[model samples]
Target chain A: MTMTFDQPKTRTENQTRTGATVEFRGLQRSFGNVRALAGLNLTVGRGELVALLGPSGCGKTTALRVVAGFEQPDAGEVLVDGQDITRVPAHRRDAGMVFQSYSLFPHLSALDNVAFGLRMRGVGRAERRARAGELLDLVGLPDQADRYPHQLSGGQQQRIALARALALRPRVLLLDEPLSALDARVRLSLRDEIRRLQQELGITTLFVTHDQEEALSLADRVAVMNAGRLEQCAPPAQLYARPATAFVAEFVGVMSRIPARADGATVHVLGRTLPIDGDPAHGDVDVLLRPESIEVVAAADGSAQVLGAAFLGAITRLSVRSAAGTTVKVDVPSPAATTLPVGSHVELALPDRPVLVAPRKEQARA
Target chain B: MARLAMAVTALRGRIRWSRGVVLLIAGTYFLLPMVCSVVFSIDVPGQGVTFDAYTGILGADGFLDSLTLTLELAAATVVSVLLLLVPALITVRLTAPRLRWVIEVVCSLPLVVPAIALVAGIGTVLRWGPDHLADTPLYDTFIAIQDPDFPVVLVLAYTLMALPLAYRTLDGGLAAIDLKVLVEAARACGANWPRAVLQVVLPNLRGALLNTAFLTLALVLGEYTVAAILGYRPFAVWIVGIGGSQAEMSVAVSVIGLLVTWVLLLALATAGRPRSARTKTTAETS
Candidate 1:
């Protein structure tokens, strides 16, 4: 960890992919007796944006703070490039951070706020201002350099915060729920803006957020954490499509548990035993099916009664009750989305995608 | 019926008018004595109303010295309070919670122990002995009874009364701010705590601190108990002494104290507060 922290390398766009990298090694931190991070481990590759997706109190922000050196880890180390910064003081660590509040200096103009870090590092006023102006322009706030924080809207302040973080060219940027306070419209707009900036700079970034759409859309890989543990760390599609555990499957998106009797390779659900993905024994297990996978049809052939339906633009979502009284949702195109009314029979089909399964109530992690 | 309604309306209007008159009369009654002091300050010593009272005040033997002494005392009090109060208030803000309460109680203890009692209880105040302040001791402070620089003693008495109020006002101002904005903003910029406090947090507290300073100065200007009891030659005491022979000059001194206090308090009241202290929570999720 120490070795990596000392020599964080960012290639000057010589290649398309190389820039800052962060590696967390058995990082552990605690607040008094409450363990915020219990042996947490994750890595954000150079130029890669990784979102630490988790529920509240799941230590996702704690992990980010530890990496940023705001909160010291009781055990293990945080390595940027190859140097360990577990014991590094927050200031000397020189990591860029964008906070949930956008934390823009209230008294400073947008330009000066962006230039503040450079000035702190002993950069001259003229050069720092020029650089700050450039960064603000990069963030699409060129003419707003003179605006005080209150004069700008919420989105602009966040953009300024990003520019300020990038001012000193830190190897890794930590965003602690940086967009958690904006309206939905602004959030969507700024999320794309942040993604674009990250790609352009090729700077390693660890974004912490509880929003699954944000994590899925912005990150190259999503590290889903729950209860002080990393449940799954993989590309967003893989996290949603092939969740490693029941916790990850539920956390990433909506899922349901079903009674399944598993025999070595195949699991039987509702009298249909096909190929199962998990390695549980011939007993009851919970299965997770994505809404997109299953389709409802006429009840004569595996049909079930429609319990309810939700109309999402471009698609319609239906929850159908099977013959065995199990309800499952299926999302179909808007044109064919009309499902059987409540109490009307409908058919449910189990597609060939590998379904995630977990042991019953008393079972351990899958 | 119409004629009776008109009479009732007239009665109500008359009652309202009389109430307003009563209030105006009472307000004037309360202000009359203070206004009379200002009016008397201009009354002539011999025959007519003139600036003689003002002139005679400066011409008096002890009055001039004490006037100089009073100005010096006010200055010293302002300086001392700034030196002691500002740092103490700041320390209270940054210290750990456990120790913060202890320090607060200590600063407030001076107020709890009445200034007169504080002066009386201390062996150093009542009886002068060897190895005292400058080998001289008189009551609360040596200067109050013997040093002739009455302003110094008066100012010391002012600190005893004003320190707690200053702390409270500043603390209230500090409480009104969102401290997290400063902390997180500084941390995000790689600023250590000290730099953040100096450049960010303290600047935000300008209104509060300045208000405290002006208030302390005003309190120092009006204080008389510690000076009078300790044999200090403060302006208020001198004004009291001269009221028998030269009432006009004494009134002039009273008017000066009132004017000085009013100005200081007005400055405090008009100080500008931080306009941008709210936390800017940008986006909830993105």
Candidate 2:
């Protein structure tokens, strides 16, 4: 009967007890002509949740599989807690993995399914069942243990998969797109559940997902991969705020490509010369400005017009075509939704700080 | 209301007629022969609804022996094929992919060589083995295809025919399984490869195994050419012994063969039912 979602500490820190560290040195994999992973190097510190975020076939899953030992890298080593485990078989590596399908043994009751790994280890029936019972309780489903896997909802099945993985108390946890199968609300709630559990157990977990919002919301750091290469690896906030490459900027979060020409000390934008971040590589430049950095004011005394408006619940995304015929997307609070109409003149404001800029050729389509 | 109801009734009549036409043709083609067999099995020419055909076959001196031998051969083919195909498939995939391909080619070689070729070639070799096996009546009597010894050579030959189908079906089953789940789950629990294969791999494939076994059974039972050429007697060859006059006997064997196939289909259905708990229990318990 207790409502716990509003509590400050309920979501992030109760379960991540003692996290483990994972290190990969020069991991390489290839499939025919496709170079899936080439000399990839990454280190995940203890108690940190790092998301290997990339589009499909970007070598993120390959890296996760290699760590799980489901795949053997063509070269390089995988080390967990300073132990070389490149050759260690997946099951012997002491890492718990939760698959996207929630691959629970469909024929076993939830309780017995959770206890399967322990039973295989020859743990006596009484002790294993007791431990399994405790895990089911922890995931908030003690009553459903007797039900078969098919009898549970998608969310419940996922919780059982997690409990089964945790049953063995593995050092490093591997989650392969674990919540990509759920409905939006279920996904949000389960993500919070995962964040909470990781905090409590402090288990060193490697999560692989194609979702950028998921990576930003959950991980300590996000590693972006493109065509089997790691483009950038840093804290989520830092990576989102200051992406190392044009790919990182476009892939990590939303941004708009605004045309600008570098004119020595100043750049030409907004039909007026303005200054932005970095020294250019000469020629025409393209500056990447975040939508949050742009503001709309009434025009005539205005510099822009609202070309289109879209309602997004709490926010309204406005498509504004500037005086120079450049289109930009601006997100504003939903309360301003009715006030901003198409063809209405509006003035665009820029923040005082430096904005991310690159050459038109260097800027990714955003 | 009257017009709508009349229209609906006419529409229903049209629907039934369209459905009935296809059923009528199919039923006449397949069931007429089957109905005739039942009628023949019990008819007494002048007398109505009699069991003379049944008694006549049972009363015939060697008919029981031939029937018994046919059943024996079917059982043998099921057993031998199981012994050969399952292990062969297991090792084939477990080996290198290249080597597995070679084994696959070898298993399928029988298809290229006809059963008659196998019988002719082996029959010739056996005839030349130190002494001509055909010189003894044992060779001649065993060739009576429904004799107990018919399936020895019969099943062995059918194994070749049955193997490709069995291997392919089983291979499909093995491919469909989440092998990683089984192997990793077992390994984490500390079970080794053989144990994992037995407990995990084989059970999931029970449906395919049973299906192949049944198909193999039917094939061995009905096999005529190889048994005839090799001078052995299977049910098909034995039924041919009545020289087209004992159409009733032939009909009887066909009916039994059909029933066996159905039994096997049921077995296959049973095998596929989810038993992950009990299966795991028995696997661990033993």
Candidate 3:
């Protein structure tokens, strides 16, 4: 059967397909002395894709596990569709999970692996087989139904895993670094396909990953976490542009710390003043600038000297040392790095966009 | 070129000598006893070559009885060991992984305990059993242990002795697959513990199960010490008793037993191989 993914309307316009709302309230989990989730509270809106993004050991996965009913929280409740399901067994929770390792049953063919959940639910064999075939077609792997896991490629295995997870038509989907195990090229294409499918189904999904770019690209809302707590939760653009805390700003993207002085809502950095979100005490602080915001020009009388340059396809990242002996990274187009090679003097300039600032550290002895 | 040819010839000569020596030793070790027994059993010197002893087994009174009893014992041992082991190992591996060392130690204790020593210990235990269960339903079981028609004690003893080999085979199979992941996946698909074990775990372990069963069968067929001491005439004990009055018949039975065990082992080796290995060539042709 050929399954067509022809949902051309935006996810918001396709609001006719309703999805469940999932909420984790004050979830606390600990393994011995290490706290996995310290009072983590977050809610996923109906038909929205929320990503829990963090470094390893930041409890992003633990939060997803609690929602999936694989783990029990020590002092909290998980509510799905506004009803508490904290005590529900994993099999009864009606949540489908796609693990990082594919986790396909090796002995079963792809069709059987996809049909497994329906079989367990007591669906007729013919009906389950038809449904599984439709799911495989949906993932663009219709002909791979008869192939075993070992007979398929890594990418094919992951697609089969995803199809299996969606076969049950679960109310909520949980993905734990599903694309991290693949190569770079496959990872990109598969992630886009996943986003399209998730939107088509309109299932409220919680994807956990340490890759910031993936979280930003696939999630409707990205929740950056650190130390078992959410640092910020917002749309990708907002989380990248206007991070609520220093940790969120640093984790979401690359940021360069430059000495600056804060005067009310404006901060002065690199011999220029820029606007910030809120009014802070008029004192010395460190300004955080995105590499794209910093411009570099080669000039003999410049105060900064280029220390190194790395050509990264469209943009070249340059490491420069300021007159005060502090290192700052700036990204420029490829052609610009050729003229401003290593040891070349260059002037650093900031754009009009706002920059984040934190308290300045004590100067290191030069 | 001449020197190189001489060196090559020397290497070939050395390889041939070693291969011939090994072949001769192995051929003698395996075939010598069968050859001697065949010759000895058939040679009724004054009566010339005859098949008397081989034919005598058919007319022997207890031959069929002992053989049937041993077959029954083998079946019981295979089933009881599987029922006792498969679930316990799966549970221990999946749920209480910390108890793995203890299970391994207990299963392997039979290997260290000699068969004669085990029989002596079992005799003492059975002697104490009657007095303790004199007024209970268990008294009937103690009495049934002495039955010669279908001895249950031999089954119990064979099952215990087969534990170490069965455990190793099953553990090897379990190690080959990601048991925890498979079981958890089954559970997530809405399977209960029993359903998961029966349908998911056991089917994947077909090879291990067959290997353990056949190994237990072979062990039951060949064991003699405990049955002889218990005054039970199992196949092994029966063959020895026949030897007292009819030496040639005993050798004939021994040859049959050896052939039976070889067939079982051969079947075990091929049973668990991947199905694709057999069908790939056919698919290629089609």
**In model 2, what lDDT does residue A283 have?**
52
Q: What residue runs in model 3 are displaced by over 4 Å at the alpha carbon?
A: A5-18, A279-284, A361-366, B1-28, B38-58, B279-286
How would you encode candidate 2's per-residue C-alpha lDDT over A1-366 as one tens digit per residue? 122222323223335445678998999999879889998899999988999999999999999888877788999989888899998766577777788865776556789878877776677888888778877877788887787776689999888888888777778888889899899998998898888888777788899999999999999999998888889999998998889888988787778777777776577766565665656445587778777777777665576788888888998889887665677888888887677788888887676666777768542222
| Clash tally for model 3 | 0
- RMSD (Cα, Å) of model 2: 6.9
Q: Give the lowest summed-lDDT range of ten residues in model 2 chain A.
A: A1-10
Tens digits of lDDT, candidate 3, A112-165: 999998888788888788878888989998887777777788999989988888
**What would the TM-score be for candidate 2 when compared with the true structure?**
0.79
Q: Which ten residues in a row have the lowest lDDT in candidate 1 chain A?
A: A1-10
* Candidates' C-alpha lDDT: 0.74, 0.76, 0.85
lDDT of 1 by residue, A1-366 (tens): 011111223222223333567888887777778877888888778889999999898899998888776677788888887888788777777578898975777777788889888777677787788778778878888887777787889999999998898877777888889899999999998899889888767788899999999999999999999878788899999988888988888778877555677777778775576677766556777666788877667564444667777889998888776554456677878777654555667667777656667786443222
| Candidate with more favorable, higher DockQ: 1 or 3 | 3
What TM-score, over all chains together, does every model reach?
0.83, 0.79, 0.90
